[model samples]
Target chain A: MTKPVLHLQPRVKTMISNATLEQASYEIMKKAAIDIPEDYLAGIKSVAAKESEQLSGFVIKTMINNYEAATEDRRPMCADTGLPRYYVKVGDHARFDGGFTGMERAMRSATARATIDVPLRPNRVHPLWRTDNNNNVGINSPEVEWSFEPDADWIDITTVHKGGLFGTDYRMLFPGDGIDGIKRFLLDTLISFGKRGLCCQPAIIGIGLGGSKDTCMQLGKQAACLRVVGNRNPDPKIAELEVELKDVANGIGMGPMGFVGSSMAVDLHIEVGHTHTGGMPISVHTFCLSSRRATARIHADDTIEYRTDPMWFTPYYRRETVIWENT
Target chain B: MLNKVNLDLPASPDDIAKLAIGSIVFLNGIVYTAREGVYNKVLVDGRELPDDLTSRSNVNFHCSPAASKNENGEFHIGGVTATASFRFSKYLAQWLDLTNTKIVIGKGGMPVNDYKNILAPRGAVYLTTVGYGTGALLGRGVQSVDAVHWLNELGIAQALWIFKVKNFGPFLVDSDLQGNSLFAQQGELINQNVEGLYDGLKEPALHRYGETGNRKDELM
Candidate 1:
């Protein structure tokens, strides 16, 4: 069967100049909001009892409190923004006034601006000195996972993924051969970190298997951005593995905040791609309780699209909020 | 009469480390607001803190969820999430001593070691509070943010304002001198013997001795 290409619309493409990028980031931070899915919340409530044998109510309330405080303060739910990544789908047939500056650049600009203006916590620092660049303007601020298709207008952007933290993502190291190695490594890395490393409760595991080294990581991040906090990968095999890992990792006894309980891990997602036989790579990224991603579909004529799933709803930012009505 | 205790927030790692094993203290009021990651970075970075933060608060670290106040004049704090103190305990003591600042209220107690012993003389203490109850603990009104600090390039975007709390916790004891950890000691004693179990191997003896040693005892 021939692979089918999806038509998409492209609009005016902006380079996202440093100033503009900075402004955009501030816009996202100050105004950017995420609508959490009810099902996701329900999942949290449901498994919460099983996860934490005791004080389940406390866990539920704490989770709610964390979300409430984050929303109220208008702060990035968690400090770690993970390896910044973006998966932008631009319609091939659609034409933007400025043309394409490549998805990576656009995302980088947005990330740079957000890092500074809205000033999402710059979790990206040197792996060595441990000094925080703080600007979110690291070697590579935001990674882009781009998929272009021929279409008329509109650019659909989804920032719904969770940030990937080292401790959480790199906990268990499962280094299987080829892609398997990467998969194993990601799992082992997460397990190694334990619950404390996992940080918050209701963690979502995003896995990218069978891709290039960098691609693997980006895929993992993109997977998170697309899925809700508590959903699983659609693939049966991957989903099963996710369930197995969930039980095994939780069994490690790294309960909430690594104290002692059953509720350490929550959701696990795995995204797989076919790679050359010899050099397959995989990466697993983790997002904590705070699922922080937003999406907007800007049409060629200036329209908007939003993603709504039972697990979450897109939050309306400042601009999206109606400021004034014209008679 | 309102008995209000006051303490200076911890400024240096030594300030954090020097907190004695057990001491009655009211962290007078100078400190920053931060949680584990921020705290970990601050200590590990070894970067000189902004002058104001260094001189102002006793210490700061991020606490999850939220901190709020209650109508009865108590703080309804939540998200007193447990942290891996074993990793930071020594680091904390060392910093407390250097800065001469003491006292931190969080969940769990500290490990017993030679370093913690120093706190005995320094009059430092590790205060324990209920974890998983963030709303209950932090209900006390927040006074103000002490300083603004950010790490990584993200700093350029927005400087996360670190706050200094007016009143943070009950300041209860989790660890004390003579190397006692209520959290650990209690668990250890329980696991070692089955004192609470009524239907143990000696149940038959107890049944035989029911009421008393004899019929009169049974009647009584």
Candidate 2:
């Protein structure tokens, strides 16, 4: 059977210079390393205000102080200024002056520049040979994932700082296991690796359910990167599951820093998708309390604007807010 | 059992033994920064301890600090990231036994049984530092960083650093010389709660996904 072809209108062409894009990438990386996003800042404040445990409160206060100090001193919020990971949305209408490879070169240069400018700790090392690149621009380092937006004329780039401390995990379950199996896997993961391990209590839990292993893992990454701490899935069932998981996770009494506390996780965000009848794959990714991210949009006219939130996995709605002036 | 105390480096075994699991301590004097590379070098490769390291009370840190050099070529430590302790437990235990190290400062829990059997018996304790407050902790507590060693081979991530500190903690005695571990206790409580929740659910029937399903089961 032949697939049906749909007629589509042509998109307006927009030429973006390599130099301009590279400069924008450098600025975004520098800011992300030094400053915690405003949304994350607000979440930390809210959690601190509600904290009842003495030790937990003290730790939260210190974290708040650390944020302020990092901003004022122009130093990294955490010592582990993690490996740079860019999630980019390139518009179909956008054309790079030097093509896709040109854009790749721009990103690589930007990463190397940010390493020294932000003075990010050189965390990249040869996996087997154990060689230090010093500037974090090694083999397959500065991971970038690309997606396309039809009919758009600008490119949107979101930089997520994934620290070395909080690690990622994935699991595959049979259809027979059902939601019960998911709950067990999630709870077990939290008990063993959450509060103390990487999720680091008061963490933002991102759960990806269904689909293939890779797809589920990507979904999990997106879920973990929700704009705000308490953002819920649009689907009611999944949203409710998030709330239940949050409550159950907090019930463990790990508290902030895994000491005694009432708040274990600030929020849980679950992203769901359809899977094959025989199998279900689940991936859990965590953003620690720091939850550092920054985003920027490059327009058709070569004007760049920094966004407060990337709003990944959703439609890009333009807001009136811009942090950096057009360059 | 939460007592606020100040402990001087090279502390006596009696002083360490008196510390309970919940005791909060402020560490004073010198602490050495040692990570996996340092462990591999000193313990695995059988390298001799530097005179400066052995002369001081062995209060080692499981951290790889972020530092930058000034125009004068002197390094200014901006912050410290505490690595997970479990990754280097065996080497840490061996190093402690060899050096009579009084304390090991790190984040995330280590092997409690091993610490109790090896570290505690050797007159040492495991201290837990604030994991996320790396910047604040370093900026406020650490007075100076000097006498760095092994930079040529390990780079910054695993180099040995000697830090002069003053009132450098709000550390919890997670594993004490009395053979008690705060992490072990918490793990027990967490395990009990999780197991109880799982116990009420009916077991799911077995099913397989993909050609590699059997391999996946073994891996999990």
Give the best candidate by TM-score: 2
**Per-model DockQ against the true two-chain complex:** 0.05, 0.33
List, residue by residue over B1-220, the lDDT tens digit for candidate 2: 2578898887777778888876778888888988789888989898887776867857888887767666787776766667778788778667987777878888775877877787877888888876455554555567887588888788987888888888877777888776788877755655555557676554545433442456547333
Per-residue error for B55 in candidate 2, Å, reads: 1.4
Report every candidate's CA lDDT: 0.46, 0.75
Each candidate's TM vs. the true structure? Answer: 0.61, 0.86
Off by over 4 Å in 2: A1-15, A49-51, A164-167, A195-198, A316-327, B1-3, B8-18, B70-72, B207-220
Q: Identify the CAPRI category of the predicted complex in candidate 1.
A: incorrect
Please write out the lDDT profile of model 1 over residues B1-220, one tens digit for every residue: 1123344555334544444432323444554444445445556777554666545655433233222233563322222232334445546655656555444445445555522475445545555433322332343324554445652322321233455566554343445444455445433433342222222212111122332657656431
Model 1 has a clash total of 114
